[model samples]
Target chain A: MSKQAGLPVLEQDEAVCCAPMVREPLGEEAAAELSRMFKALSDPIRLRLLSLIASHEGGEACVCDLIGPFDVSQPTISHHLKVLREAGLVGSERRGTWVYYWVLPEALAKLSALLEIPAVSAKAPA
Target chain B: MSKQAGLPVLEQDEAVCCAPMVREPLGEEAAAELSRMFKALSDPIRLRLLSLIASHEGGEACVCDLIGPFDVSQPTISHHLKVLREAGLVGSERRGTWVYYWVLPEALAKLSALLEIPAVSAKAPA
Candidate 1:
């Protein structure tokens, strides 16, 4: 979207562009794309599962390595991982007996970049 | 959560800690806290509204300035704004006839910090 909040809505070519949200109003299309990614992170189990995979050794974790810590059932964990994978936050591959998962740096970086409000952007609401 | 995926859960002293998710598995409490913030951002309209307010002149915007760009009813927009405020993503003030809103940089920074997966953390899923 235009920084000036102009009336005309334009197609944003880069949904994952580097500009922080503090830089401009997001285009409807870009917002939808990014919001899906956030929605995947909206659940506690999903968030924890993502962290577990990301922080695991080798920067990845097999489904076998993932099932131990959580109180939830294996199926439930798989569902959350599916949500993360569907949202493009993580990528997974089926390797014979088990599936491996890892956080996609580009996807996480986009969300990180979008949320980083500079100190100068901090102003009182009033 | 412990980096080793130990069975015992510990109290995370800092929910808004600076360490990225890639650094370690997130504690349950921190995941719940952060998931609420992400849930608030899950909606595309809410995401755009936060961006709009953050990018406004003086880093703030009045309700009057916020209603023009979207096709949604004023009440719908207000609902989204309320969600953002409640999630600690934005702060609001009512001065005279209109309410003003601005992004809370600290809250945004926490999310930014959490999601910043280092390039070194990247690995193929397989």
Candidate 2:
């Protein structure tokens, strides 16, 4: 139930309630759905393998404990964990020959409520 | 002064307090500085030119009122506003002929506190 935990703080204050990303432009279907989730967070080894599977412990982690902390090529860390499990931001299981991965804190809280910014709301108008 | 307004909510609750992006992977100089700011937010024409310079109206916007709402070209919207002002996430002045842009809402609140996820903290252990 994570998509920003079923949103509604006025839909996370209207995920920048249209017309902002520099004052008007994004609408080729919302820039192709926010650039396919920022191109699955445009790498950096998938944001440090999604911060090592959201800081492990039991949140979950395993692809052989995330391949000896990178030097690339375990098929490029299995292609950045298959692009962070196809951008839902991690959630794999497999078990028997290992696969783990967990952190889906509501797709990183819907990409932090789609990069929120009311910017201390009510100031830009004057 | 954006970079999440000079960070501090205990550094935005320790930006997920290290160790989690699927339990460890990000350090090639922190995935090349968070994948060069998520590859300058991996385009969609620079997220609709940073949401039309963060919803214009004084927060800022101009490049001739953002090239009449897209279809590209104007040097590809001035090369996606110079990749959102080199990923500082929008900010330009120039005024001479034109060039305005603004929305640096602390670099989108330091990328919403680096995609924050204390996820109601502590529970992963089991």
Candidate 3:
């Protein structure tokens, strides 16, 4: 399967190199690409799923392990996981009958860094 | 005017105190609240607008200054600024004929902190 089928293939490299949003204006194309990642994070279900996956034991969880805590159907949980994966927030691998998902630290770090308030501006009076 | 009309008053306190997503599973209510802020950030135009406002001189920009960089109309820029304000990412003030907008450092810090990977997990093998 094409990598883009499951993740933001075209922008992954850019994601690593892009400056924080506070440093300068995000170019039109960069904003479009980054917004897709943020859009996936805009759903409550997806946020909870990503949290669950990220906080899971050893920083990963199998689909079987992920589905039990939520009240939603298994398919619904799977769908949310898919969204997280496609947004590049999480990665998954099929191991026999179960797919294990793990948080993509670099992706999360990129976003975390983007939201960083510059030191000088952060210290400025509001 | 009610604070909720222009910003997420109900969730601002929660945003201030919530733990990083990598530290634990976010509760349903917290996830729902945060999703709204992330939803506001999901648009490309809004992101660019925010970046412009943040990096502008003195860490603030007037609506007049914000409108010139984009291809869209003035009203469109205003709409996006409203979204940013309501998400708590920014605060605005009416000064003369223009509304001045500035990044809310605390709000951005909250989100930056939320995405932070725990030190242990961040150091763990992928």
RMSD of each: 7.9, 16.7, 8.0
DockQ of each: 0.49, 0.27, 0.50
Give a tens-digit lDDT track for model 3, residues A17-102.
35567877888877887798899999988998888888877888899988887888999988988988889889899999989999
Q: Model 2 lDDT vs. the true structure?
A: 0.65
Error of 2 at B78 (Å): 13
Worst 10 residues of 1 chain B by lDDT: B5-14
Instruction: Give the CAPRI class of candidate 1.
Output: acceptable
Q: Write the per-residue lDDT of candidate 1 for residues A24-122, one digit (tens) a residue.
A: 888888889989999999999999888988888777889988889899999999998999999999999988988999888888988898898765555
Residue range A1-126, candidate 2, lDDT tens digits: 455655333432334333234434456775676677778877777777777777777667788888787787788898878877886677888979888887777656665556667546312422
RMSD (CA, angstroms), candidate 2: 16.7
* Residue B114, model 2: Cα distance from true site in angstroms: 22
Number of clashes found in candidate 2? 42
What are the models' TM-scores?
0.85, 0.32, 0.83
- Highest DockQ: give the candidate number: 3
Q: Give per-residue CA lDDT, model 1, range B94-114, as digits (tens).
A: 889989998888788888988
Which candidate leads the pack in lDDT?
Answer: 1
Best by TM-score: 1
- Looking at candidate 2 chain A, the ten consecutive residues that score lowest on lDDT are A11-20
Tell me the spans in candidate 2 whose CA falls farther than 4 Å from its real position. A1-30, A37-39, A42-45, A50-62, A67-83, A88-95, A100-126, B1-27, B30-34, B42-45, B48-62, B65-67, B70-83, B86-97, B100-126
| TM-score of chain B as predicted in candidate 1 | 0.82
lDDT of 2 at A117: 73
